[model samples]
Target: MATEALAVRQAVPGDFAGWLPLWHGYNEFYGRAGDSAPPASLTEATWERFFDGMEPMEALVAELEGRLVGLAHIIFHRNTGLVGPTCYLQDLFAAPEIRGRGIGRALIEGVYARARAAGARRVYWHTHESNAVAQRLYDGVAERSGFIVYRQDL
Candidate 1:
């Protein structure tokens, strides 16, 4: 599908139904499905945060023919290394059936636009190293920071 035909915009409450499946798909891709899936409460809170004025999180969606096919979740936070807030693209996903149709790219560009509008100094996200297909797309739009990520469960 042509990128122009995709409408990337802020997600609204009415989008919940369509957005849920894509959100599940994203988690499943990261090995977070089945028994490991995130708690329903967590997902509910995440969705609510998007529309909460006090929250710094936002969600963008890509629609084609009135159906949501992609989603990008972003968070803006203060970074000690920078004077302005930095945007972290927390999650991004495109439906499996439309993986190569530029929906993901459009959603990413939408995040970039939101970051810029919010005065964020930078925008970044991480993907599993095994996701070479996504890496190919990431390579064309942004540079790798060469910084490995580490996490420890509390």
Candidate 2:
């Protein structure tokens, strides 16, 4: 596959149909599918966020041969450690068959470009400890912060 030909761009309203499957696959990879899946309300809100100018969330899609092959959702927020906003790449996924072909890298790089344009100080994201394949790619592009994440449901 010639990854050089693929294009990454901000997602548009017409992309919802193609982006849905990729969204489900991403959630399933994280054990959030089927009975444990998020409610439709949450999904709707997420999609809405991408189109809402008032929201700091944005989504990028990878297109090749007129087909959507990947998706990345990014969020810009203020952080106490930085004077500028930080970009949080909340979700990233490339089609199973297209993994390792540079689609993921393109999407991440796309996010980085967008962050830079938005005056964000940094772009960061986390993956499951078991996702070594993804880690290999991530390691090449960004340094790991060595910070452990902790969370509790209220």
Number of backbone collisions per candidate:
0, 0
Q: Which tens-of-lDDT digit does each residue in 46-107 have in candidate 1?
A: 99999999999999999998899999999999999999999999999999998898988888
lDDT of 2 by residue, 1-154 (tens): 7987899999998999999999999999899999999888988899999999999999999998888999999999999999999999999999998887999999999999999999998999989899999999999999999999999999
Off by over 4 Å in 2: none
Clashing pairs in 2: none
Q: What lDDT score is found at residue 140 in candidate 1?
A: 90
- RMSD (Å) of each candidate, 1 decimal: 0.9, 0.9
What's each prediction's TM-score? Answer: 0.97, 0.97
- Candidate 1 lands at a TM-score of 0.97
Candidate 1 lDDT score at position 77: 96
Off by over 4 Å in 1: none
